[model samples]
Target: MAELSAPTGREPGLRAVPRPDGTMPRALVIGATGYLGGRLVPRLLAAGYAVRVLARAPERVRAFQWGDDVEVVEGAAAEAAAVRRAVADVDVVYYLVHSMAAGTGFEEADRRAAQTVADAAAAAGVGRIVYLGGLHPDDVPLSPHLRSRVEVGQILLDSGVPTLVLQAGVVIGSGSASFEMVRHLTDVLPYMPAPRWVRNRIQPIAVRDVLHYLLGAARVDPAVNRAVDIGGPDVLRYGQMMNGYAVVAGLRQRAIAALPVLTPRLASHWVNLVTPIPRSIARPLVESLQNDCVVKDDDVDALIPPPAAGLTPYRRAVALALGRVEADDVETSWRDAELSGVPSDPLPSDPDWAGRAVFTDARSARTPAPPDRLWAVVEGIGGENGWYSSPVLWALRGWMDRIVGGVGLARGRRSRRRLAVGDALDFWRVEAVEPGRLLRLRAEMKVPGLAWLELRVAPEGTGARYDQRAVFFPQGLAGRLYWLAVLPFHGFIFRGMANRITAAAARAS
Candidate 1:
């Protein structure tokens, strides 16, 4: 394929068009699967740029709403050929990929990845590069993570590309690392024995503001190529930020005591135990918090004008993040980028059922209703609609889950009538959804083993056959004991559930 032409020194405000014979600037987004990158792609598309993404595992981002809109180049950033292909014929390249969560040797790996992209972009004659880096004062010693970001930014700038590096502190948005840390810390603990770093001043920027700056970078003049520091209007201690979040979330003010003895290692371990954030990523972030990260320059403000409504405040940003959680509209999460390191293929077909101690309770009932009716009844199984069979028993289970730090049943469904692949349905997440045919829910509730409840409807002689299967993959002796302990309840719950669903379908029919 012929390389797309770079953006000419054309008239300002001309949006890029994706035409075969037009001079539309093509923007390539590396790390499109990350939180900010995932959100930025849609904004770029709306701004009339033909966006393309480079991802290691394209399947991971296949669930994105804009997955089909952008072209995907499947390869790792470490590969020279892959980087060349990704940087090919692009007017601007957003280098948003980072490897901090890859455990050890991430700094060197990050530098190598940045160098590869920088060399590739230079070779491709790319017009410009936009990168988001950490905000840290030059006087203070930087943590390994923050230092790596600074190094990466310098590498891009030294590549002779007109690079616009935007340095930001904690991003206050749903699924952002900083926001998640604040959210989990505030929500889980009423009293915190935090480290001295919690008292350090930090200026957080809303994700919306960050995206606005990023989008505006594309329109920035090529001559204005330098690092710009951007942050929210509020500058407060990390503990105060958590307090503000609690206020917005309608939770009681949490009491936090600063302890000088608490090291970053201890804090990271505490975060790992309390929040979903792993120790590997949380350790660096915790260490970075020791230095104040409030922005010191207004260069970005001069380059990119503020949004129409102005920058969002910390409290409002917290409210917005919580609102997304409440509405179940979280666009992307930190968990999405955490690769499982295992193939996500479907369960094996024709498995040795006898070789493994797989326990399953399969129940089938012929319903007078059609498949659609049966499927509707199956789809509306949890949330406000209740479990159809035992409401009290389900509530008890949910309470148990909550006590154990599971999501429990409070999240509910995004829509009571509709279901999607990643939607939360009470204590279970919708793993697979097939309209009028099948719905598989993976249990998120606290349990000793992995469990799935699958419902399938098939055409019968005149109506449909409702099949409900409870499959459990035990881990060890504890898992087996757990199954045995719950064996009696399964007989009552599963059997009752199957009968009630069939009856409900019949009524609906």
Candidate 2:
């Protein structure tokens, strides 16, 4: 029950540590920027642990509000230097980094990463290493994905670091791929001819509960170091899960017939053809599903106990997943084909905009100043600044929105310099604001479907490059027509807007 020593200088009680009554210990969470890692870091901090995190993209790590609260070390876990720096002076280490996103040879990459973590943890004199892996009964012939998962855990265990391996099935959460898959399948497909794996009995865990066990595992005595199977309340067949998801999503219960002829690879391809999720992610996921993934061990219950309340039933988890989709609360998705790096040469951009009989006129300008200076001018747009283009046209657009009861340009910024969540900027609501790098605004004005105006300023040469991207999400046939109708004048409007902003910034400078 030893407590982690607290670092000082900054805040009063914020910097104070609990008396090391041998109660709490320090934890270092690798992959702290990932979905599970993101959730776990805050939980550990709340549990009174001086948590440190090692992230490949430290900027992304710093962007999270938790970055200020925890020590952020920027580097990959495979890098010995970064691992040594991260693992030093930590009681327990959480190895959560995986190369699943690295395309092929994911198994080999995972093995090397596990070894790196184990070696680094041992060198730094870490007490325990807690690893979260996928669930698959050891008796069954494991798929490559599940095999890699178990092998990684084995490597960690063999590292001579007292390791607690938690084997979990599909995690149901907002950002989780498994949950999103269930949601998408149910939402997009009313009827499905599924593969034989549809009969596979899988016990899916909620992300909240997975996090609970992980945090609990970190605090458990180093003496308890063994792989434990973890799952949710229900052990339902994959087909049943689909039915449950459809019900929760307010969709008609779809009929799924298991076909023996449909192989996992073929099933994966089928999924890619229908759902937004790509084959690269879908194939591995579908392949893993061929094996029954129900929990075999009940040891985790003794350690962490059942999650308190609001434990999402399979139905409720599906409901939440669908709810997230409706609310546009997506954090990341396998549908993000851009980052996948799939070969196609001139990789097409967001198809939501392209192939449409619409107009998209984009304009960029260069300014002789830091990105911050350029962004300052861009941010000061709309309202009193009058959009830096045609004041009369901006007013007319506002008038049109007013006729339709939309927010229009009436909603101005809360403050000139400071911006917070949900703040308004003329006809747009600030969707996201990344200080000097990006400022994205969602148009609240009446549009065809969804519309956004994003201004990105990146430092280039001696100055900054200002790029303005105007995105329009059309609804149906009428939306397409509206876009096409306005296509001709977009060139003039967008170009004028971009140049004026640059000119305004130049004058201010």
Candidate RMSDs in order: 6.3, 12.6
Badly placed stretches (over 4 Å) of model 2 are 1-24, 324-433, 436-454, 457-509
Question: What is candidate 1's lDDT per residue for 81-152, written digit by digit as tens?
Answer: 988988888989999977656656878988999999999999999888999998898877888888899999
Pairs with backbone N, CA or C atoms under 3 Å apart (clashes), candidate 2: 1-22, 1-23, 2-22, 2-23
Cα-based RMSD of candidate 1 = 6.3
Per-residue lDDT tens digits for candidate 2, residues 362-392, read 6789988777788888777765566777676
TM-score of each predicted structure versus truth: 0.75, 0.67
lDDT scores of the candidates, listed in order: 0.79, 0.70
Best-fitting candidate, scored by lDDT = 1
Candidate 1 TM-score, C-alpha based: 0.75
Pairs of residues at least 3 apart in sequence or in different chains that clash in candidate 1: none
The local lDDT score (0 to 100) that residue 383 gets in candidate 2 is 50
